[model samples]
Target: MHRPTPRPLAIAIVAGLLQLPAQAALYAVDPGPYPPAPASGFPAWYQDSHGRTLDLCLTKAVSSRVAGAPGAPAYMCTLLPTPGVFDDTQPIVFPTNFPDEAFWFTADAAIVDAARGINLSFGTAIEAAFAAEEPKAGDQVSFARVRIRVDVPVAGTYTVTHPYGVEVFDVPAGGRRAINMTRDIGIAGAGDFSGALKGDVGPFLRSVNGPYTEGNERFIGDPNLDEPVTGSPFNTNFVRIEGPNGIDLRTTVFSVSGKLSEVNRPTPLIPQRSTYSRHTENGNLRAQQDVFVMAPPAPATVTLSSQTPALALGEANGTGSWYAQSVLNPALPLTLQVTADNSLAIATSTPTTTPMPLTDLVVISRAEYSLGSGQLTLVASSSDETSPPALTARTGNGTLIGNLSGNGAVKALTTGLSPIPPATVQVSSSNGGSDSEPVVLVP
Candidate 1:
């Protein structure tokens, strides 16, 4: 969901009260959920065993009101993800020489890898600690490490990365891991871009922390003004993870001025929220940006009511409902019923009234074929039972099989064709419901 930025007057009032010559500060009004600290201390998942670290360090802040006292400004600073790699082994400094009044704020971070069913938990202790740093950076300095941990129940190859750092680990069937790393909040700052207000008077500072590799961070300032900052449109500064079968998982934080907008992509596997505002506080605009890394919902489980070991080509067959269990929504059950004519229909309600046509569902279930005395019978089934199934048949390798009649039966027009492998009958319903079974043709 997109959230609109605050009003300009609100930003100006907040900025006025918090603005100071030495520095200015903004507080995270709402920090989302954080993973809980394990009772048994940090687990194996929490440890940085691979010693993976981030290469870039920077922060972004933007505003919506670009024509008044609270003009939108983009602020940034250069820092390191780990300690000792830079001068003196100390953490990167916030509010570094950026011409704008620098301040630090903290927001809740919720990181998830849905594909592996992994959701991070930062206990109340860490949540409180993260919330404690408000309006200013107190006791928190460069290289401050926050411990993050996750337990993989099913296990496989799991990768979790954010703008601040990245973690790629292979877990056993049932295992856990933990690691401690610096928070991105340490290296964030804000400034104004409207050009109407100079210095850090009405600057807003925010951070986009995720694992997006391309166009991860972007900042578009007012174009009318001359002497605009070179990096007016900020890009890059994120980590990208490649998973099994060309699955690309990119996570990053995104913010815009006018109205809150999400990170735009071709096919976004997961849905995330952005931290953005249009107005300013005491002339400064600041908000906590929550980054979400989501995986596509798991496929639904499908089961056939009865299995037919073998069937005659010309014989008419009957089958029960295709029971489907949804991974995301289990309470709502789904069933696919196939008529003798191969008409497929779906039922969401128990009584099964007002069954909509399969065309309305817009999903193709499966193509079935049977053999008989010098003849072939082809049938197709889908989730919609209202409309008749298509009369066309095609092979896995794109060869034309045969066309079905009005009753969903087809006879082989060609002779002397070799026996093909048994066909597996399968159908998929809405919301990830699917089922399949094998049946052989008998002489």
Candidate 2:
């Protein structure tokens, strides 16, 4: 029986602010002065115990409205999810260069050989931690050793901190995702992109936007920037993820940005909210940027049904099954939930419905596929009572396995990625609710 979903009245992971939505299209903010971290090839940070470390040293004060004033000339950075996730607010903040080495990080335990040739793939399931706006250098910020599951091969990208770090884990035969869960990233700070930002900030961001976007960090590579999450308009823009050894990654970023203005469709998100800024007093940190934190007023009787905030990729091994649309009732204003895990909730959003009344609340839940550096034979299936359900499958951003039929499935293969085993393979459904199951090839 279809159970009518009720309004969820729970605090998000941060317990300070509510997330927007996990999968909402994020705006192109600053990747905090980083040209995409290496997308593929060897990882930038890794560890022996299935975990990786990222050491960001704060040398100078990160800008806060120039003179700590609103609308001041400052290049500010806020932690946001890559791959268009915006709901996460209280991201995890690790001391990359903390005074000691005892810090620990319970990292997302999934890795993939995105390319067959030891190509690393980072997991976007991890959210970002908006650290205090401050300097970058001298002050050591260490991503505590993130532990990967010892059994699965940690071979892809994983979110160590605000940036992406490559990790590798041991995988037994038939093992796909093996990352340790209790290690930390320990490194010193080193980067000179600040020198590049001297003359023009736009060029610097543009140059690095590809790496950021490809790394699933925030960058304005989205061609579908104009559309809402569910609307088809989100597909209009082209934000491609390129690896470090990505042959076309650099070029593609340039091509898209060159014509971004001409596209004439992409616009800034939260137009009313200027880039965020903060004014810190002795004890209070006031927001210099006037942020209207209220959600866009919804009209309908929208409510959330259920959510799976946290998921272990290993549990998704093989063809597992989960659905997010069971809470959707055709009558009440549609309020559906897929994940309730706080860690993965980095990209969750509050719900608001104004115009659309609930006729059929359905979501193409958790539909995604990633190919490592090898022969990836992908298969996707769906089951629902809907007659002759519409299904679609396309690959880009994250591999989009479109709508599925009523009890339908789709499959495909590719060697286009780097030659490594997949850390994890994600699957999702579009219409009549949704489901995602990892295709653990090795396991």
Candidate 3:
């Protein structure tokens, strides 16, 4: 059964005070600055382990209030608001020689090709569809590492608002203050994206808004922005830096993806092969995301039900803002209704009444046909193969040649045609994943 969205609790707030979420702890050491050093470049870029690229560069800040203010040198970056498109908060600009690496948002520390490393240095704009991998057997977990250091023109208390939560720090005049928030989201422990209010600022994750509709459901190019753990109007990702006087710079919300896991790592206590799937099924009261325990040999016939404050899985994964899966998919506001034989742990997210397509949720690696045997094979894979996408094949003329409800990864169907038809083969998924390759004659 679907769990209902939690209603906002009644609370009072004292104006002009920084509010941290209830029970949220401070990061011991923040993830430091991006670029990490000096560099020469205009528009720069960094690609994560999964090949997801974040482009950063210098652009002139624009603000009507700062008339004749020589628009401070600000940052123009890509990743948030959507991948490929450049957006900036036009924060007060940096000094002319401000090291490119020391800019506002730098891309750093990522898991690539199953190995961990950092992709430093900005590059030219590279356009690519946004994609993220679910944490399963053999795949390394990924996450966003962030730290904020603000050079105060005139120091006071600066309130920092981001996708996860809010942070207020004090900096002396002309002193640089670094908010060590590197531990916001991690495999172990909780992030600061959700929870109760300590002051006026708490969960800063966006809810519902014009153009930013669907809250945090998968946006067209960004499938990882679906924050179903919190449910309706899924919140997108962003960071707002506000300081004394009238200093306010807010980034355009963007989308990214990551997951939690326990392989060689001792913490987070996740099963080795745990994974998840996000979908919008009929009758769902809110956004729907479900988890699974990929227990080797075959996919189990396990069921999931939404539960308030989650269940044992939540306790097992530790606590805080980090969800069971990607902040995009999330793992709060829901849990698994496990069977007695179910030893694997799982969690859930808020349900979505609306459905959206998640890119690469099902990826088709190869589709080919053997002319000699007239045998056609479609090889595809999803994060969760237990509930794989429906596979369909057709001719160029739209002739339905083969179809199968995907069971595992490879689906094969022999045309059995005595004389193989001279046409193309196309494969598609019920979840909007697809591939088309010309009919290549192969022995």
Candidate 4:
């Protein structure tokens, strides 16, 4: 189990207030297929079993470059202060940037090798494009997964703390135990796609034929009117992970998918003619998962706040589509306060008076210049991949050099510097993070 350095009085007070029970600690581990190439040296990183890179605190957009089978031009986005993933010091919020509907998974567990004893693996994937099917087709969907392998292991308790809540399992030591958890949110009947909001699936948003309003008033219409729901602790919207275990072939898996988007497809009854219909009719298209590792000493004290002006606690943009939760205990719900465009502050803790600046999230990971070609290659990453940071360069004397550009997280500046390189190269992002490194002449 891994633990971070403790805070003074605040932590002591929190422990006394929460009065949590005594339990063994667990930390997250990267079970990797590993990256074929480097992310240019970033922390909390790995190339997952599925060939997708899992770099903590950063957003990764997985989509298709061709007709289907999503791959290529992979996005290595910016880093953000994601509390639970790398640091569980804050509550996990959904639809991070209004309409983005970006849900994530983080873990607090250790990485163990199978040959030594336990074999573990983890990763995530999203659908390539929208398609219909009898057997196979693309529909908007995404998921996170973990695979554990061990033999004739110890007999003890296995606990998984995820975004949803904490679940406990008792193992007898020699038998096979398989854990499966699933959740699906979206339209009436779109069939088998794992996507919730309209923006995720298509250009259209959810709407009804006539005027209607529910007394709840949180949303204009029943957002989850006719959607399949599963999982404990939450009926909808959550992600986290936890583990510390023995052998006995223990395998855990979970998936989240939704078909909220209405698209053109052949009516189920009539196969030939194409008709506009919801995807729920297809059924069981995708899945989801996230992680959380519990360690000794003390838990990270976190505060829940809205990134934007939201309507209410557990609701965003006039709909009950977003929420926040307690990573430690599922029974104890986290609180939120909405004061006219203000953030969602936890009732138990003091709210943050200032928002986190972009400089804190965006960063220049590495930069270098080639003496032969006079080309400078810069690599950067951000937690907010949705809003990629634009990059620029400057010289020691404060003169503008030239802009850098490249696909994904890498940027390149080929023009402007010739005979002599700038004494000092200062690279910066629109998001505020910058790095100044000496332009070492390299052959």
Candidate 5:
């Protein structure tokens, strides 16, 4: 079984602490398919089985066109600190984590910032127009998704990246097949690249998303061998990072001149926690981050507190309807007291109830019993309002059960019949729900 990472539990020292409203979404939609082609370069970064582009951190909007070099027209986005800015005048570098590989798309960008709480009007307009005609695999779906979250003071604004997966693969500019690298020597191999490239791998470079390694770093050539080489991570090429906040990065083209380059980063109060790969094109060195503005390590003291709010069950679709409602108060774990709201509309007495047993095959006069047979029996019936009880007897396999009258007290003689070998009795309600109840036939 594929198990998910277990989360830690928090203890509450105080009983009543201020609790935030529910933050997780109860329902979600698929982000859609993966980019068809690998970006201009970066073959090693292929779309995983799920169809998302490897360097999917940055996806191009429908309006954008793919250019061979930097400074073309494309939509670059990122997940930055809340209230992040997108200036048409400033040079904003959207950091794709593979800093060493050349970014596939290079163009002018206009960001609709989520951290700043900007509504996705621009993207929505494009989607509305295209909604009249949906986009299939080959066609482009201009409907760019905006990752959104609410802002709480202590939590800031939670950030998520929406990977747009429609038509950004092999057209004139997209790729058809995924290219694989580093099978034998592996992702980072030994005895590759040499001399000045190793000093600061900025040479021997090529495309984005593909795999390569540089510098004097060591790699596993075989199952047992591990050796070093002096070369550029890639062959001396450059890539650009474009986004509003995806990368907490500040540098555009990090040099992979073998020696570590200063890939400027944001001064995040919360630190980063992940390892980087030496894989690159030009034997160059650059920096990277897996997730954007991840929350700080869980607080040492996590306090879960809340006041029990009023909760009620909504309408029932049917008996088969899976009814569930969680009144998740950070504080109380109370057992729910469930009862019928307007029970008068429902039947007062159970349609079919199993009663106590009598002799093995024979049923008693006054007692009710579902003796593994398909009928309920009245043990006895009361007479008139002012008269004594009158009785009747039933026998054999074919018999019907009747309701009590007058005082509705069933004393005797309403007994029903049972088969030679009684079979199980299944009761079906008018509401379509069914259950088995006891029945018996007596001599």
Candidate 6:
């Protein structure tokens, strides 16, 4: 399983001794995927797999008020790490004492309020919830889902530590518990909610009705209420809380589905090296070539063949394709020819052709010259039907022996007169090529 790296918890502490303003004004309400409307900022709520709405707040001001409400409060939600900021950018370290037990908690509205206050009554509820939902033997408990409300007032942007999973903590015995709520929870993986807010309204209807639909017989009124809901999913994070006493901490894993624009961008095309080769007519010699290309644009083709019948040729292969050929005669020298066309369309401003020559040669005859003869005679045969490749002769130390004719005949040579070893003769043809052979010179 590929888990995303966890980021440092952006802990927003709620200190009892710290003083706050007597009153604070409401900034805005983020309704999230329900009651469709364009997101004014990062979402303050998200729906779990169970279809329950989890309200997220950046500060304790709103969350504490809701958590302390007399009746059923909105689901408390916390921010998770943003995929853009935390994913692949930071290391996630799990606590050494992290618990292994998993338990589910379903607190009544009153208990939920008490939990928000981190009180004894809330701990009692947690114990009960754990006992009631303990997993049976042979069953696996991956996470715990507790119904709690959390909110923060100082909101600009903050990451949710866990998106699809809940974080668990063991509440220690009474003391100034330095509980860093931020650092306590572990991060699940990434989740996307892009399609969560998109309503089932057809595209045609959306275009005709604008942001909302007119009241119809099938429905009471416009569900959208003329609110713009089309936008990208707010990539954020979430957190869950449990235990100070005997509460066993464990996570209840859930899967979040949808595409994230931050992670799903267009993939650009890349160019690969192209190749080709010559083969024999009897299918003995085989040369294989391959190339890689992306689609939507037409795939490119590579051409493989020798200029002359000295070497057999094979048909061109499609992009990422290969072919085989055999040499007609192994004893003679041959050149494999390769040409790539349109392979550079994706990697260059303008498409260009690429050609390469691969040589296979075996020496057949050596050239002989007399010292101070100023002349040399050489003869050789090759696989090239063109015959009589261009020739050059030189000493062991690279001193020019003299220029030679296409038939391996040279005149006006001078270096061979020295006590140097036999000069080296090299043969090449327009289509067929050969390896260099030693030339013997006599005084």
Winner by lDDT: 3
TM-score of 3: 0.23
Higher-lDDT candidate among 5 and 6? 6
Model 6 residue runs over 4 Å out of place are 1-301, 304-352, 356-379, 385-390, 396-398, 403-417, 422-425, 428-434, 437-443
Please, what are the lDDT tens digits per residue for candidate 4 over residues 54-163? 23322233212212223222222211232333222233232222111122222212234454344332212221111221112222222222222222234545454332
What order do you get sorting by lDDT, best first?
Answer: 3, 4, 6, 1, 2, 5
Is candidate 2 or 3 superior in lDDT? 3
Clashing residue pair totals per candidate (backbone < 3 A): 45, 102, 27, 54, 76, 34
The models' CA-based lDDT, in order, is: 0.25, 0.23, 0.32, 0.29, 0.21, 0.27
Q: Write the per-residue lDDT of candidate 1 for residues 1-443, one digit (tens) a residue.
A: 01111321111111011212221111111121211221011110110101111111224332232332332233322211222222312323432221111112111233467765444432100111111222222322121122234544454455544323344545445444322222222221121111111111111212322212223443222211211111000121223443444545443322211111221112111112211112234865432211121211112112211123211112111111122221121122232221121112111101111111111121223333345553334333433233233434444444554543444211122222346643543333232323344534556
Model 3 lDDT at residue 196: 14
What is candidate 6's local distance difference test score?
0.27
TM-score of 1: 0.23
- Candidate 4: 10-residue stretch with minimal lDDT: 267-276
Tens digits of per-residue lDDT for model 2 on 1-443?
00011211111121011111112212222223432321111112211100112212111222321243343222122222222222223232332222121111111111233342222222121111212322223332322221223222223332221122222222333233232233212222243112211111111112223212222233222221221111111111122222223311101121111111111111111211111122335765443211111111112111222324321111111111111122221322333222112112112332222221122112333422244334444544433323223444434335653333333333333434344443444444333322334444431
Q: What is candidate 4's local distance difference test score?
A: 0.29
CA displacement after TM-score superposition, residue 59 of candidate 2 (Å): 25
Better of 5 and 6 by TM-score: 6
* Better candidate number, 2 or 5, judged by lDDT: 2
Better of 1 and 6 by TM-score: 1
Runs of candidate 5 exceeding 4 Å displacement: 2-399, 403-406, 409-413, 416-436, 440-443
lDDT of 3 by residue, 18-52 (tens): 44433322111122232222212121332211111
